[model samples]
Target: MYQKITVQTKTEVKPQTTAHLAQTMTLLNMGNGEVEEEIQKNLAENPALELDEINRCAMCGSEIAFGVLCKNCMNNQLKQDSQYLTFVSTREFPVSEEAADNEDYFEDGTVDRQTLPEYVLRQVGMELDDREKMVAASILTQLDDDGFVDVDILELASYHHIPISSVERVKGLIQHADPVGVGSKDAREALLVQVDELKRSKDIPEWTEKVISDHFHALLKKQFSEIAQQCEITINQVEKIANFITENLNPYPARSNWGDVRNPQENEMLQLGAPDIILSFFENNPQKPIMIEVFQPANSNLTLNASYHAALKTVDKETKMKMREDLEKASLFIKCLQQRTNTILRMAQVLVEIQEKYIREGDRYLKPITRAEIAKKLSVHESTISRAVSSKTIQLPNRKVYPLSVFFDRSLQIRTEIKEIVEKEKEPLNDQEIVTKLEKKGMHIARRTVAKYRDMEGILPAYQRKEKVKTK
Candidate 1:
């Protein structure tokens, strides 16, 4: 008989190229100013890297200054009347000293229109009736930053004139919304909800829920040996379950609620600076083709130092090795920078193509799109698209600066609809009446959501509006 031997093998996964990773780290996620700062930092550190005296436009190869397109190519682009033209420029609007000093005013969560309560309400509101919605709203609005319910259920029930069971039911519904555990009473409750959600779709370890529910304190303290003793499982099994929980679940659900995208507060601040991209109509007419400009920090070309290369041959082996390393680093940086520009140009073209009407018109015309959809069109990872758009502002043809993320805000169209509906209301309509109107217009949303959107627009409720109208 042939001898049977059991062999173990290690599987090696190939990693991304250094150049690709460098590109991603250096330029893919950086804003215009941040990219400029990175390039300047590299230039200062690397003797082998130098800025080209004769800067050229990447498109037409015409000589230009640092960070911008040649004037001739720009004129030709406009004269051609292309549907949309993407060019690189460094021109920026000057921000006031007061604005610079008060950057915190923009970055702080105060101006964020998409509050967590509003976001959670959008998710859970549709399943609730008026009373349940009020309860849900009360619970959601009172949540701490971690998305845990901060208020007492008994007090809330008393205030709303509802049974404690009704409040409990509403809280249960809220807990099951996206992010899975949001609105839970505490971290333990949040983790339990997440485990329940995981169990629905996939087979988790049999002891996962038990450990989370019964031995949660031990788990939190990482007393794996004690948990193993109590649960009668091996320490290794308990460790694996711990690893699974760490990988899959979050105790603070609100922190990761939006996925890879920036939270609403960050989105609000992103629009404060000079726009990274500008869309303008040809010859100042909306009927004409749109000119799209993607801004770069520098107009000059980043190039390798020829003198540094020449001196490398004359140096000792030690110095020559260092010089060669510098040359490689410089070349990689240049390539990555170019890749960044190309990626943004391609993305800008796609955006203009899909959202041309919205660019020419207003928020009412915004076509709903997701980063994933754009990434699919561009044959890139969704996170790549997210990084490209993050912290970048875009100026529309109407001279208003908004975050590039505004292109993907799915709620904009509905919010616009609500504004229009409210604007044209014959009498001040209640949220349910507004919902019926929206249903007729092929838009469906919950009444509470209608209330939230109306609140976002600073519109008064039906009774308040009626009272104001009577006063008028």
Candidate 2:
């Protein structure tokens, strides 16, 4: 089925004379793991393709003098202020046969692990138009620990100045996401949404929705006899419905597969591997040039097979044509790989410069930036920048690894402020009070947005916080 779909999609694309352009664009969006797999597959399938074990310059193909790049390439990239010194690294490559099994390259594949919100966004991003992306982003960012929207839907509709129905349409799309009931208002809503989804494919009991909607309280309290009487059904029927709900439904959308929402600290998280890029200062000095190391998974350069080229020259005409096709493919793959590396390097240079303070200082200093801003600086499309940053991680000098997308996170500063304000509050401040406080600090945002950010940081509501204070 997967192959059929892939073939169908490929058939839809018009034949292009510029193979390099099409291939490079495809390679640009692939994560490191996917690229490595592509390289390996090419090497196995094409006799003309070869992997050079020697570490060499990605740009000039010269033997690397010291690091990943030759001295000349390094000098050409260096600037007077010395703000950034970015280069690709081959440290992730296996050094010996024994070490290959446990090398960093294998582990680095897992760095693209997505949080729950991100996972959902990937599914829905392509389906949404530009305006709907904003609405979707708003909804996803506001999800609480239970995967329910923390803000009022009407408030969001008013804030975005869109019709309430549009908001519902977007929220409806989210509710059908992986956990199957996320973006719901509460457990009952989530369960009903789940049941609705289940009815499409499964043999669900017809009275399941009725029992949940009309007698949710009684259902929870196990008043099966009363529910049976109200619905004109036998107690045995109610028990069967109860059994189905117990076996197939989860009231908390985030509780299954997701981390333990009840214990926010115990959220299940995937272990991250080596970073795709490392941000540091030259000579480990703050005043020195900033160094960015982009990891090359193969830890080596790819070159054409000289033996195959020689053999091609002496082959029959038909054989020569076939081999030449292989050679062209191999050459194109290498060029695309280099293009991918260069694109990432260019992006990193701009990001490190724009986010220098945020990197050197902390989240409090994060300036509002967007992918469009970076794309403009680089003379590329916004989607190009998005593809380069997607699923990539960067390790800072402080040794904390963060997603490459973090550089473009416009909300980080405000979210940090919200967290700080809550941490130092004299008493529990409601969302409106927090909004007023933010306004005093010159960070004006809607009360609902404040609530969303608060929920994102796992901060309790004012009443909950006050109750906890009383307990203390």
Candidate 3:
């Protein structure tokens, strides 16, 4: 049997403008800074458009600079709502033992932790030969926050082009230096050395010594019964030995009393310079719209004088047209910059609204969201959404802020509710337990899938979580 059929349907394909196509192409190909630069160039070329400056407070006409805030108005506003305060949480390092000294080394009589490395070298002095000192100095350089040399002896030896035995000898010498535990390889070694030093001054029992050196695993596993059986002692004796080990252990065995400190590396900051525009979610309220400011040149208001315009009119027509084109290009640059800011702010507002829950809470409450969802909602391609989010930070009501890209993650099979179920389990819940719980809630996920989520969350297996009640 042979059959022929023809079907026709009318469809309208909307044509894209040159400007729209250019904007889309730029968004797809360029980074945030490049896109911003392109916008600035366009604004510089477009003469008709001018960037408005906010020299005074919009609410109360008072001159202000440095920030958008007018001093008196801001102070009054803060005083009016004293209860609504902002708090910023920050991380700080604990003071080291060396800093406790009252000796006046500098103007404040306190040596900065940053100067500790040089201080240690100066204290050590030129007592030993240069070679031995170099070896010792090399070991000191490798010391971690706890003052112990965290790297392997062989690795250090190879790096320094010295024999492993010589490296070990140098490390030993350094370990016996000012900080008793300095230059020791790892936690276990550091603890053992510190224990041995203490033992030299006071008599430590054989059981305690055995627990530190031979039965460290037992102490870590908290296997009191096994430790008791091995040591031919009761559970109480094993507990005492465990306590002794804990008391003797130097948790940060590498940290020396010297003032050496290091600063954390800074994360990259994104900057966009253009005139200011505010994007507001509320249609009726314009006063409290989201303020978007484009930074412009200080002398942006200065225009070509009347004399210069008259001089330009006297010039040849071809030269005058070229001059006009140049001015137009600069003005166009400015317009593009404004448009870029507007687009970014609009996209950011949409994202903030969509991820309100995550903004309020944090990672725990983060929903499984994607770029495509946002793109569809915004009536733009997925690539547009990606460009809008890249290198952009959104400030939330709670003073909580995060990168827009943080919201766009791969969908998770384990939702917040399921995660809470796993977390709230009385015992250490394995993948099987998680799977069972999910099934009970009408979510049929495999044990392997549960395991995958657990792994993603950085949770270890059940065997590792098992803790013994006694130490040998």
Q: Is 2 or 3 the stronger prediction by lDDT? A: 2
TM match of model 2 to true structure? 0.65
**lDDT of each candidate versus the true structure:** 0.73, 0.73, 0.48
Regions more than 4 Å wrong, model 2: 1-18, 65-81, 93-176, 179-270
State the lDDT at 40 in candidate 3.
53
Q: What is the lDDT of residue 198 in candidate 1?
A: 86
Query: Stretches of candidate 3 above 4 Å error?
Result: 1-20, 23-66, 69-312, 362-365, 398-400, 410-422, 439-449, 467-472
**Residues 1-472, candidate 3, lDDT per residue (tens digit)?**
0001011111232465555544443443333434545545544654433334534333244545633334554465456643221111111212234433424222211232232234455555454455555555555543433554454667556645667777676666565555566667666677777777888687665577676667777777788898888878888988876677666555344332333333411321111111121222222333332322222223222222234345566789997887676555444443343344444544555555565555445555566666667666666655455555543444344333344445664324355545677567666666777778778866776665566567546566655544421221
- Across 1-472, the per-residue lDDT of candidate 2 in tens digits comes to 0000010101222333456755665577666777777778888999998777565655545565444444654676564444466566665532334324434325444533456667787777887776676677666654555677654678767756778888888888888888899989898999999999988898997698999999998998799999999999999989999999989998878656653223332211223445678888777888777787777666336778989999986889999999999998887787677767877878887888888899888998888887778878777756567668766778888877676777876678999999999899999999999899889989998776787678767899999999999999
Model 1 over residues 346-433: C-alpha lDDT tens digits? 7888888898888877788889887778878877756567567765678888877786777887778888999998899889999999
Candidate RMSDs in Å, in order, are: 18.1, 12.1, 19.6
lDDT of 2 at 42: 85
- Order of candidate numbers by TM-score, starting with the best: 2, 1, 3
Q: How much is the lDDT of residue 90 in candidate 2?
A: 60
TM-score of each: 0.62, 0.65, 0.41
